[model samples]
Target chain A: MVKKTSQRISVASLDDLVNVAGASQEQEQQYRYHICICVAAGCISQNSDAVRDALIAEVEARGLEDEVQVKGVGCMGLCAAGPLVRVDPDGIVYQSVTVDDVPAILDSLENGPVEKLILPQDIPFFERQQKIVLENCGIIDPEAITEYIAAGGYLALHKALTEMTPSEVIDVVTRSGLRGRGGGGYPAGLKWVTVAKAESETKYVICNADEGDPGAFMDRSVLESDPHRVIEGMAIAGYAVGANKGYIYVRAEYPLAVERLELAIKQARWAGILGNGVFSTTFDFAIEVRLGAGAFVCGEETALIASIEGRRGVPRPRPPYPADYGLWGQPTLINNVETFANVAPIIRNGSDWFAEIGTEKSKGTKVFALAGQIVNTGLIEVPMGITLREIVFDIGGGLPDGRNYKAVQTGGPSGGCVPEQFLDMPVDYESLREVGSFMGSGGMIVMDDSSSMVEVARYFMEFSMTESCGKCIPCRTGTRQMYDLLSKVVAGEASQSELNLLVELGDLLQNTCLCGLGKAAPNPVVSTMQYFEDEYLERLVDDNGSADEPAGES
Target chain B: MPAQATAETSAADKRWKLVEATMRRNGYRPDALIETLHTVQGVFGYIDREALKFVAERLPVSPSQIFGVVTFYHYFQMKPQGRHTCSVCTGTACHIKGSKALLDDIEAHYDLKDGQTTPDDKVSLLTVRCIGACGLAPAAVFDGEVEGSVTPDLLHERLDNWLAEEDEGNGEEN
Candidate 1:
């Protein structure tokens, strides 16, 4: 098949952008069918790229290259059964496709659906999800600017810049009830307003894509699938907050995400969407990608800013948050990738449309990376207030092989494990905090009865201890001490006094740590102790036990 | 501190030119320290003391500060990697999926712990927090290829095959 270049359009005004969108749509209508193969990291690792190559070659051999648009797209959500291929019009999704299966996929495009290969699209994994952030994820070719334009990608930025004033954009975001998706549930609009109101003439908008949560990949998915969406969101944010420069501090581990962002930025710049005078408005916005060199603490705004400044990612006191003084001491607006992603949609759909979805406090949907023992382990964007049961059992397809659900871990090292009793609990920011966990970058690792709660606590403690930046006494020394005590408990050698000491350390860390990392470090241990006190008691060494026989003795 | 050290990182090396290009793009400022080091490591596979001292001089950063930043980030490695590298995912999902057993099995089988290379300079093993592919639990990257649903036996089998190719290549060289 002929290698295609991303269609670029130079738009000087809103009408020009609309015409570009129309022309892109008209071009897309030429193809009788569209074949989008999952090319996100998850599916790519499953050799979907090679399958795409094979399908494209086959398309060439069949002389149907013009009729069929065989392109690589982003994550299809069901990652476990990738490489997933979706044929348009019929919306038939084929999972676990191989190079050898390429011929059959093409044959089915002409013929009917391959009955055995079809992954039923009506399942809760697809049907239950309400896609706001991920609306154009698997649908649009992330590399193609025309595809994004056709999908109504940058119209929100166009609308925000041309129609509304800076404060009006901020007002819409404020009324939408959207909060930061970067673990901290700070209001996104409030942050925009503060930066907009700040006295500094030189303001910066930083997209915090340094998603360090171990099990989280929401940012990665959004970046990999629809990178221009993030670029558009940042542009809108820059317009609202009176910032002309933007930087995305994404993690280096996600090489694919970095590459996609770089490519998308180039495409945006080439199309006159990123560089100076975007959409012919006097507003000048430029975005550059800065790679995070594998530090989890950099997810913190202060630490992230420090990292971007080419220093060690160490968190300092936050009285002067990033909103006030950030990125070389400028009034900066930093929003999580998912938070920024919500901006364009909120603008297009209107605040009331966004506010009407989900719970009272947490409006809009959340994208979760469901992993661990869950059957449908991939990515899901569900409305807020959706219960953990619906997420784990219905959307996730529950624990595999009929295992009993023990706990579902949210928020990586900083969050807690929710027991079976709270499976029905609505997964919003406030509700998760009530269960001693917070809506951290949306990574839910569902565990079955086979998992030990104490061991899980020890695991998170070890993560915290190892990842500690050693800048603060409370976090550096405290995480180490807590990790040691938890290790002893896991080894069945900890006494009741040691467990009590661990609780005390948790309180001390929460109260005195320098940053959120240290403050929330003890959450997993503390939450486990709260709900599974018996497990700790059972593991505690008996006072009257013989010297040779420890608590682990039968 | 030495002019001779600057002489060693001469502009003729071409590798230093790439490093110079990165610094030049950042206007040779102190803030280019991390990006400079990233380019160094990306080109050389690992950053060394030589690269560090040279970068410290080229950019407006101090040696102590460059060293501090380099060591702070886990992605920067001081030593050269072996011919092949295996990175096991120790993310929450992988840990729950018996990645610990896989790790232990690897240690026992290779007689090397995390961040260690085989004495023959054939393989290096390390652990990463996450590669953000938790859907494939107990995943590991063999060289640049990521394989999922890895068990102790499965990894060992893969290693045997991967190393067997190395052995065949060596035999041909002899």
Candidate 2:
């Protein structure tokens, strides 16, 4: 296979490859209107595939197949009302589309946009988004490599292999100020530099796709929508880190994402984009997929490494981090799926372009899976430092059913809930931590006034209790104790002393857990206690000093 | 190994051969334990004692450690399953959207608990957390197919039909 194709394109072919491919594709398929249906997981659940088929059939029946082409693309981000269909060149998007309404949609293509059926594209939900990670999403056929090539995929890899030195590649990422998007906001450049400078004969790069955070689908969407982009990003990372082998550790629960990624890898290999002498260079890199069997703690780097090594997925203390010693006792570079997704743009458009998008400290955009009680429950990528108020009210379409907003939980179970008072706070790494939350893998769940804060705390505590790897005593027993205490408090059976004990235990878990899973387990409990202590007081037993009464009569 | 050439033992021989092939494909290293287990589960729905021992021997890991790895992960099933399986999402979003009610409804219908199989071996029910489809809260994975926004009435009807179809097929087989 290597000998059959010319790898001699090398550094010289880097500049013209993508431009030539994209130009030819645009010239060949110059349709008047392109009908793109949202075939992401959210819309697919609402039977978007049938709606897509109906649109194609309608176009074919009207003999407008050549004029109008219907294609299935990734998430359009307005998932609460789906299946969403967008007509390109006209910019008319229809929401909650059904097979019955396909004719009216096609008719609107001829006459005018349907008033009731058309979703307002001018709304902040679509307008306020700064999409760099999701640049080609919802616009390209993910299953086709030619479409990816036409969309300028692998251009960064070609340029990096041909133009930039390994250290120069690392410097560009460092200047971009790109932090890790997988919960922890560690600087990705520092990690890459350490791995690049590691004194080892063999090194490995890992793309952590085990998106275990509840309500987070950003990684899955990226992989499903533009798998080649992640591949290109990873290939570029492999080049910069001086590693020739890569592994993508994705959860097995996402069967669709796994299938698409497998296909993308195969296509890249067949096109000579993944194998040895990629872009006609001497560098040889191959990627393999490893499936995680439903372990939440595997999202932790050490635990993920253990899972990849075919052992019980458990975390060890850090010092000899994966960069220094990892994956069968060799130097390994690990980054979140979203972190790698941001690599190509930084390399192609230059670091200054990316550094200008977000806040002064947190550069570039962040993709979040906005869901729960929000009217526009879907995936969205917005610039860093965007306010929670803007994300929830403007982008998320606020609460549904005219309900009053209560609080929004960010970073899944590892994060805290921010009350309406902090709605205007900018959503950056420092701001989130200041509010007692960490940007954990981009799951922002909105809670309405109908929700009970105590129950929410108990829910996250239960999650932590169940998902604790039980490798150490503190996490194993501490999460269980905290969950029990929260349950008792929720049931109105806890004394004031027990509530105090719950607070103390939360502090204990905060300071003394083995891994991030246990360390951040008590975030929900503490944050709810901080903001909604009145709710807890209301749920407490009577203060009459009776048998059921709490002793502390504060 | 070639001594067992009888037709009666060919099925077992073929299963062993596949297990061997999967182990070899993974380079027969201990690092391929999880992948090997996944392949074994793909071939056989549940990892039985024989399967675990076979994986341990082929991957060169101790049987006890193999058992530890299998028990550590939530996805691995140790016992044989019923004719059908259904997993209900109990994540926070699903819980807020009344997944508990759906579970209660299923419990009443099948006279089973959250992680139990009916005495007739017709169905097994399990509760999981957030399958990443929060847009469709109160979701369920029935035989590995995600069905979202599931209501009690809808779930009951679907499960009833699924059971009836299985029974009809069983009746025909008989």
Q: Which stretches of candidate 2 lie over 4 Å from their true place?
A: A1-12, A57-64, A542-554, B1-19, B166-174
Worst 10 residues of 1 chain A by lDDT: A545-554
lDDT of 2 by residue, A224-256 (tens): 889989999899999999889999999888888
- Range of the 10 consecutive residues with the lowest summed lDDT in candidate 2 chain A: A1-10
Off by over 4 Å in 1: A1-6, A543-554, B1-6, B165-174
Docking class of 2: medium
Q: Note the residue pairs that clash in candidate 2.
A: A7-A280, A183-A440, A183-A441
lDDT of 1 by residue, A97-137 (tens): 99999888888876899888899988999999999999998
Residue A378, candidate 2: Cα error in Å is: 0.5
